[model samples]
Target: MTRVRSLTAALSAALLLLSAAACGSDGDDTPKSVAPKTAALGTLTPGVIKVAVQPYSPYTSVQGDKIVGLDGDILHHVAKKLGLKVEPQVTDFAGMLAGVQSRRVDITIGGVAWSADRQKQGLFTDPPYYSPPAMAVRSGKTYKTVDDLKGLDLGTVEGYVWVKSIQAVPGAKLHAYPDANGVFDDLGAGRVDVGFLDPLIIIAAQKERPDLKISTQYLTPPTAAEVKAKPAYQYFQPYQTGFYLPKQATKLERAISTEIDAMYANGELTELVEKYGGDPEQFLRPDDAAAAARRGVDRPSDWTPPAIAK
Candidate 1:
């Protein structure tokens, strides 16, 4: 009986050991150690993330020689999370887009608006923020509605969607310029009666030229009846600003998108936006289903990356 009891005790001990091993612990009820969470580094060049930034203040700007602003801060956060260093390349908006297309830079984050034309050229990560298009006119000009600007000259950046909106107005003269400075210059000089542009741009322009006044209302898409009546007019859409990535860099784009989604959830993106003079609530996209639906479609078939200049 004594021998049998001793054998039974040994068997119980063995079962306990097996149970502990299966549970990944020493029978002491201690929790198992978990591996630390690490960010997925996808298709990024080793050690460095080259960023092309347009000198758009509040979004991105050059202070002395260093890049700074909302997009700059966000880029730094993303690079840190990915364990990469940032190499900023400041240029005009067109140049920044070209740099991303040509692979001269890994990505760009200078408040680029998400447009169908841009989607055809490359990939834009889910929009991190949004801003509506606004109009800037001389202080003395009293315009209450988009239609009021008819018969007056309107200025806007060449590639911006504002061009289409201005074109839609009957009798309105549209003057497209290469950059914001040129457009604002014409507006200030009375060459153009109105400057339809980004709200942030309008804000900056107001600071520079106190004589300039921003409209109280933003331009919106026209009603169905208006669209039918004025088929030529393309109404202004809100800017869903996002990071631009190369066409071949799908993995990188996904990685960045994931980070952006997390940032929005955790309020980090809002913090950055507020830090750079933007309305956090207005810009943040916590639920962007439409953007997700359009994520990976519409790449340009005939597009080729530009050759990097030596």
Candidate 2:
């Protein structure tokens, strides 16, 4: 009887060991103790919020082995708040978006806008700020509206929101470039009459190359015909900009977004937008609730602007 009892006890202990081994093999539930401090942030890699970045100046330009730009600056602040470090992965614009979606990175930045189509693919935070589309022209040239682009050759980065609207122009030819620098180069070479681009990028380019003798004009919203041709045109009246995040990281996204709202309340957002994107009033304020809805934002009827609104 004593020998039988001993064998039964050994069998029970062996079964328990087997169950624990199975559980240890499946690691989906939590991160290991490598960096327990940032594990709570729910990042793929502990102790870091990996960000996909591009060379779109003033947004994600690399400055001497460091990513120093408006978006990175804001992200660093948020990461610090969460007790994590910012790890920027330099890539092209399209790659940046793809990286986050593929889980290669935790988030992407460089003026990602609020769009219903994009929202379906990944997650977006409430916009950090709003900015109007800008047209880059020769130093003394002026273009007040989209109508002024008629019959002209326009250069722009491929995959921009304004591409279709520029294509809708009755006589204009939309010259697509792989990157913003290409557009700026053609504009400076007089190869293209104007460059349709992000205001922050143009501002950074202006600061970098005074020799280019280029200037920017804040474009008015495209005409109704243009909007009809490209339904995406409606986001152009000073559209909201956000960070793109992987769909699976809901907790991480919410945490970062909460930090952004805190920054607004603390005036850090206001100060950074002014220092980089320029025009505090224009960049810090979103469109009225009515217009924002047209751009695919589901803002409430009684919604009010953030603290930085002018």
Candidate 3:
């Protein structure tokens, strides 16, 4: 009877131990199963990503209360990849910058160019596109170079770097407008003798109105000797477009840059540009380091738009 009692006690203890082990295993898994996943970068408002945009057609614009353009499409793709929703707010160029700076918007993307001045103001992601400045004149007008517009009224978008460039020309009257359409409208109406704008904008305008003609010429960065001889032209250089984020959003910037690089590697970036009636190759940098070295700029080489993915 003593041995029987002892055996029975041992069996009970063993069963309790087994039951405790089973409960412990379940407790371990319960936390993991109910644990929340880590949030993606740039998720400012939980599931919503706010983007500020300006009226730059083919890049970003409002169409009957709907945001439609390359920038809008790109933003949507990025938001989707992060399992977030995009809320695009249409504003002017200055407002776009202010929105990002004030944290009112997570980012701004509407032909926003990456430049030294802009870098000081906010952060930028990898280059999404490239655009060289070009001059446009009324149809049947001839301008072999920007100098041809000297001493005449030159229309340019206000708040654009081109404003200073246009003002640099001797006697080139500066006519600043709120947006590209205003500049193009004045050009079409002969309110300005010539218009200084992005080559892509010039092309789009020409397509819209056959009466407007874009010069085959592009504004080139002044050579070293030229810069020394004419320091006024030092600001003139090619520009790359990117999304502007707040200065403190380093992680967000990294996230967007990674997405841009991945898009470039997968041909998604090129597809977006092509779908918007742009040349994919034109937006890519052949050799960013070499290009920046040749231009004597401190811009990022790694941020260059990569070649289309095979």
**Best-performing candidate as measured by lDDT:** 2
Model 1 per-residue lDDT tens digits across residues 1-310: 0001243443444344334324532324221332122223443444556666656776688675356877777777776676665666555555566666756567888777666767777888766666654677777667756578779998877756667777888899999887788987777677988887766666666766676443423554455566577754434444467789888878778677777767877778777766654556455632232344354554344422111112
lDDT of 3 by residue, 1-310 (tens): 0001243443444344334333432222221321122154644555555666667776678774346787778777776666555666665555676667666667888777666666776887777666654667777777655456679898877656667667777888899987788988887778887777766677777777776554424554556665576665554555667789988777777777777778888888788877765666556544343246324343454434445643
> Model 1 TM-score?
0.68
Better of 1 and 2 by lDDT: 2
Each prediction's RMSD over C-alphas, in Å, is 21.4, 14.2, 20.0
Off by over 4 Å in 3: 1-38, 63-66, 140-153, 178-182, 189-193, 213-217, 231-235, 286-310
What TM-score does candidate 3 get on C-alpha atoms? 0.71
Off by over 4 Å in 2: 1-39, 62-66, 189-191, 223-226, 229-232, 289-307
lDDT of 1: 0.62
Which residues of candidate 1, in runs, are more than 4 Å off?
A: 1-40, 63-66, 91-94, 140-145, 176-178, 185-192, 211-216, 224-232, 280-282, 285-310
Worst 10 residues of 1 by lDDT: 301-310
**Per-residue alpha-carbon lDDT of model 2 for 126-176, expressed as tens digits?**
677776777788888888776787898988776665676677676989898
TM-score of model 2 vs. true structure: 0.75
Clashing pairs in 2: none
lDDT of each: 0.62, 0.70, 0.64
